[model samples]
Target: MDMKQAATFIIALLCAMCASAQTETPDTISSRQLDEVVVNVEKPQVRAEDGVMIVDLPGIVKDKPVDNILEALGYLPGVMNNNGMIWLTGASNVTIILNGELANMPLQNLYQLLYTTPVDRLKNVEVMYSAPAKYHVNGAVINVVLKTPTPLDGLQGQVRAGYNQAHYGSYGGVLAATYAIKDWSFDLNYGLTSNKSWSREETWSNHLYDGKRTIIEDDMRRIGHNWSNTIFASASWKTLKLTYNGQIVSDSKSWNLSSGTLGNYTNAYNMLSPVGYHNIALRYAAPFGMTVGGDYTCYSENRSQSLFKDTDYLLGSENRQDINRWHVYVDQEHQFGKWQLNYGAEYQHSKDHSSQHYGIVGMADNPDFDDILNEDVASFYVGTQRSFDWGLTFNASAKGEYYHNKYQHNWNFIPQLGATYYKTPKSIFQLNFDAQRIYPSYWELHGGTSHINDYSTIIGNPKLQPYIQYDAQFNYILRQKYVATLYFQYGDKAMVQLPYQSPDALNLIYQTINMNYERVAGLNLNAPFGVGYIWNATATANIMNRRAKANHFHDISFDNSKWIFYGSLTNSFKFSQNCPVSVSIDFSYISPSLQGIADLSAIWKIDAGVKWLFGKKRCCELDLKEDDIFNKWSPTMTISHAGQDYRMKVHDMTRNFKLTFIWRFNGFKPKESNSIDTSRFGTGK
Candidate 1:
């Protein structure tokens, strides 16, 4: 269906559901719950406080066909899991934390940890549009709170195994155990995954070089296999806690084949990455209200790439990086009646040893460098939160940061403010403002080059600078079930990767550069409704306008703007209490959007899953899921502005089917972990 029709249909469906809900009487509602015993206790599924939206995760996942924390996050309103990346609607980026602490690991490793964590361990999830300084994160944040083990809980454990089929086959398993006695708790989790993945990309580029327009076409197919292992262990005694998180991922057999005007080329890639993180934290409650924490992380990766043309080796490159980072923080909080005050100071240092070597057989330029980089960041912040008797709650914080590096040194001041008005139980209003600074990836600041073909190369820019982002949001919650949000975001000196053709040479360079600025204003709506006790539905829509401008982009200056729309509808149905079976169907659509200088086409997908509970006390669960049933998730990107013409289509293996089985022994609890700044630890590919 077209965009207009699809939107209309979604609105009609939601209206029809709302109308049906209105027709139900008290007696009908009571009859709907007759199958399940009611305990006469009512708990709000969603609430807003301290500029954060709290969601009762257990209630939402009770009937969903999700076995892990990562999958369960997809069910949260306004949150989307697009190809394993979790994103908040209308936000540029999102940070995910466990138990209010960020995990100090790579995004992939953090995803692995969440994927292996059982959903039963989640207590609630906090969604913050503008996180405070104490959180040590920027923009949108999703805090995944874990349930602490209680006395007499004893030993609890769970095991899960999953198999997936797409263009290839993949399997994984997880084992987690937790023990608690009195005030001491211990937790350990280990997971292993072996995955084979495949994807294909078709590119058509029209290059204007030497006053002649040349059209280049490339069809590349990528296939890879990787093994990932993750382990997390923690011990907590009273208010003191110690934890370790480690992961190792090896991709030994990854290759790509391209056949087109390039005349057939083969690229072989191999990588081995291992990360180790250690953290210790102690907190004293009551009058002191002090918290002190420190963490150290060691990360290393080795990667090699080889390119050949018709069995003739053309180029070979080797890249390596070893990084050591340490962080320390101290926070103090004091409570005075309905008002609370907090202050914190944190310092972080990272040392990176990196080297790149290139061997070229032809006349191409060789870009190689070996360098050691050191960075230090220190920040101090003070904040206050207060709740008035008039149902008004507010929080504000300002942070000052001092950053130092070999290239540059600077200081930044960030401010955050949020207020919520909930004078009535049926209606709530919230407003938040936040500002943060974003730095370039470490590798991006290193002038290194990697070749895709003889004509196309990816290069880094050493002069890249950090940027600042500002966000403001206003929210309205009706009856605690419907949410409407209006938000505006601006990125100063935004960084974007763009393809530039050399006017003097037959070369196409892909580089990440600082754009002039980017601005986004959007409105988002989320409505959750129930059709009695058997069916539950959530509908969300986001409409936004994006504008980006750049003055000097490799001899071209342009201003681009576009309006984007994204919507999703998710429904869950339970067969019956006796059968213990549930089914879920979800649909999402994204209208034409603009990214950098490229225009993206519209895309949509439908996903469905089935879950069954068996064994005594429903200790065993079997879940089957199919995603992208129509195989229409990837969007075509076209660039036709500023004397540039390019069209690219990706036919990836996004459509997949998977089956998972979960077995719980006794009960399972989770431990808290700290987050690391591994986002810049890679080769910046």
Candidate 2:
């Protein structure tokens, strides 16, 4: 019992089974209607104008409450969350949503359950940085909205506990419940996490005849247990309204790794990844504001690794791997009053099964590996949107897919267009264009033989081909809170990986091939001081060139050229009337490239945070955050083949602190200062 004493005895036995299974509240009560229905806080969405683009999480955590999940996407606007590690622009294929349901989990367990739920148990978190044919057309889309209780409730509850420490240490506890009677709504969430990690790896290799340097040390210990139970059973009498959103998640991760190595490198590398997910969602609504939605998800992962080598290691291996994914999706939308009618259809079947069980740990020769990969995909999508009368707006979308496995099975289509106009109203103007189709995931198709990365020898590519991107975004919304966006992207046949020097393998190897073209263009700037000071700035300069047709793929290279800057500043205050004070500052820069025979480098990072909101009895506010503030440690050297070279100066992951505490306990009824929605009587604009 030492995983923080079994995670504090399973969080004091789940808060004593939610305080003796509740069942006692209503002796003439309702917590005053939970403070008068939380005052709506503006977050009920429906702007069909053109499918995809939602920013609502209880209207951005009005008075705070949406623990983790990156604090409801760190309160929108170009979104970026570290620690909870949720990146959009830094792009790593985003996707996470709740309510409209979606969770492909695993960015290392959603960065430990987004710091274990906060922000008042959320009720919104939707972001689609492009890529929307109603959800799954892949690449860049995030949604995590959880909160639904009240619509005439029937037992609702929320509880949370947290603790964080930089280098290594974290504690948590959370319990969310809602059981809406009539229209159905049953959600139960329970979680527990304990973590510790310290990493350090430095390796330098320049060979022609053995010249090596290695330093590796990773002490990690983690214990995570999470569970989500959702059952949003819905229904409506006459004009239809059928809903059923089921949920199932049992996440478990138990890891322990301790290592140290050097020179002829006597080595060490250990890994453990155990994951799970199963979700289902279905929706159908009508009453003039037609709507239809469908969702089906299944994700599974199991990874195990144990490697120890020395004696100038030749080829020693011990591994176990398994990765699975299954998805089925459908969508449709309709609205009257602005003209909009969108459509959708999705079908996915994936089975990327890999099994590697080998033994021969001392001199080299290790065999006994099995690989199985069977993936099938079928998809469809359509869209339309219009609004004319000066402030003109028009949009269109399309997506089609079909693949049987082994090397694609035909069928593919992706397209999109956008337009917006406003002669006045903060001087508005916008236009976007898209035509994308990138498919090559499943760890790029079979990922194994990864000597804890660095021994390199990573493999994937069941033929690899399906890359075609053309993106464009232009914006200008000054005055009413400044904003400027300009971007352009182009890609063709791009999906490359080549780091060669394998005279029959033995270190000095890197594989993944397919390349024909590459292109990118960027610019962005946004500003706002309205809601108590807000600001964002970005400048990305890009130009990449790649070619292949003559000998060894006609060489062409460009490594992220110049300009990549970001700045964020937020301020809020209201000391009295129930406390409030928030301060934040973040910045990053990396503009100095040219490596691999063309030396030259540059990097920068910063972070700061402060919060104090303790008022209204069942109190709150207790936060302190410090991230890489001028503690930038750097070391990176690169070279693609040509005598092979590698050196990574590892350090940084220092200067870290997060001590947070927030408490709330109140049951319903306690807000009302002009509420509207008597089921909306006579409508007809």
Candidate 3:
């Protein structure tokens, strides 16, 4: 039988088993305490605190089909996890933190860590629309808080193994352990994965060369395999912590077959990347309500990529980056009756030594270079929070920064404001405004060239500049179960990757450039409800309008705008409390969207999953999930403006079946670690 048929059969069998095991009935209880018994209700699963939204993760995942922390995060009101990338509704990008601090690792490593971690260790999640200056992050933020280890908690550990079937079969495993005694705690975690993936793309370009229309069609198929090893270790004594996070990825190989009107060719792309991160931090609480802390981070990564075409060597590239960064801060707090005051100052410095080399068939087209970049930043901020008898609370802060880098120097002043009104138990309202600046990737700012095929190439521009972003959001909570949000965002001097066909040659070049501005205004609605004790559901929808403008793009300039809509609905069903079986089905849809000068088509997907808990103490868990059941997640792209005409379609292996088994011992939990600046670690894509 085929894979889809097998998945259907397995789901049917599990349903039958659950049905057969629901023979026991719940026992009735009788209470005779003055005719009527008073029972207090539990705390709400979601609430507003300060300038953030707090979600009770444990309460939301209880008796649900959630298997890990990553899965649980998808249930948040405006959060979506699309193929391991987390995005907030109507927001550009998001930053994820652990225990109110950023993790010093790559995005892929962080996702893997969350996938292997047990849900029992999560205390709560804080969603911030506009992060405060203290967090040192722009845009939206998702803070994952873990439970603290108590004294005498001897040893805790967990082991997990998983297999996935897509166009190919892949497997992996994880092991984690933690120990706490007296005033000391230690944590160690290791994971290994052997992954295989596949994708296909077809491009049709109508080139207008020398006033002649030429139709170029190229079809490419990509297949890849890789092995990754991740390790994390930490030891903490009171307020001092030493942490190490490392990842080694080897055997990274990919083969791309391109065949069409152009010619028949095979491209072999091979890469090996290994990264290491180390951090040491110390925090002390001194007299007169003062706290001081400092952190030192050392990070390094080496990546090499080689491309070959049909047994003929084409190009080879090596990229390396070594970074040493440090930060020191001092904070003071004061209490003035019903009001609280907080002030802090921080300074940070980073030294980066980055180098790149290219070995190309045509040596004159590519060059090798090395450079060192030094950056220093200093900031100071003060904030005040107060709650009045009128059921209103507000916080405001302003920060001034002096930033100096090798290429440029600037001074910026930013202000943040937030307020919440929670007079009634059933209604809550909040408003926030924040601003920040974003920098370009390290590799994107380098002048380099890489060839994809004979007629396609990627070029980097060293003149890329940083951009500023402003955000405003208003949120309303109704009955503590429904949420409505209205938001606006504006980006100045935005940067985006655009494709350009050389007017004089037969080459198509892709490059990143700066845009004049971009604007987005949207409204989002979320509702979560339950029907009896068998079914629970959450639905979310977002409708927005996007506008982007550029004054100088190659030989043409244009303004583009579009309206988009996105929606999702997730349903969970429990057979019976005694059966220990649950099922879930999810659906999502995205309307036509706009990116730069391209217009995208609509896309939709359906997914399903089943979970079973068995063995003594319910320590064993088996989960089966099938994503993109109909295999319609990929969207088509078209660009036809300013003499640029192109069309492309992608047929990737988005549909896959995954099975995971987990075994826990002695209540396994892991500690949180420090963070570093890894946003500019690797080469550009």
Per-residue alpha-carbon lDDT of model 3 for 655-685, expressed as tens digits?
9898988888885533331333336655644
- Model 1 residue runs over 4 Å out of place are 1-42, 272-287, 361-364, 668-678
Q: Relative to the true structure, how large is the alpha-carbon lDDT of every model?
A: 0.82, 0.48, 0.77
Using Cα atoms with residue i matched to residue i, what is each candidate's TM-score against the true structure?
0.92, 0.29, 0.91
Error of 2 at 44 (Å): 12
lDDT order of candidates, top first: 1, 3, 2
Score candidate 3 by TM-score against the native.
Answer: 0.91
Tens digits of per-residue lDDT, candidate 1, 582-604, equal: 77899999999988888899999
Q: What is the lDDT of residue 536 in candidate 2?
A: 24
What lDDT does candidate 1 reach at residue 103? Answer: 52
Deviation in Å, model 1, residue 297 alpha carbon: 0.7
Model 2 weakest lDDT span, ten residues long: 674-683
- Would you give me the overall lDDT of model 1? 0.82
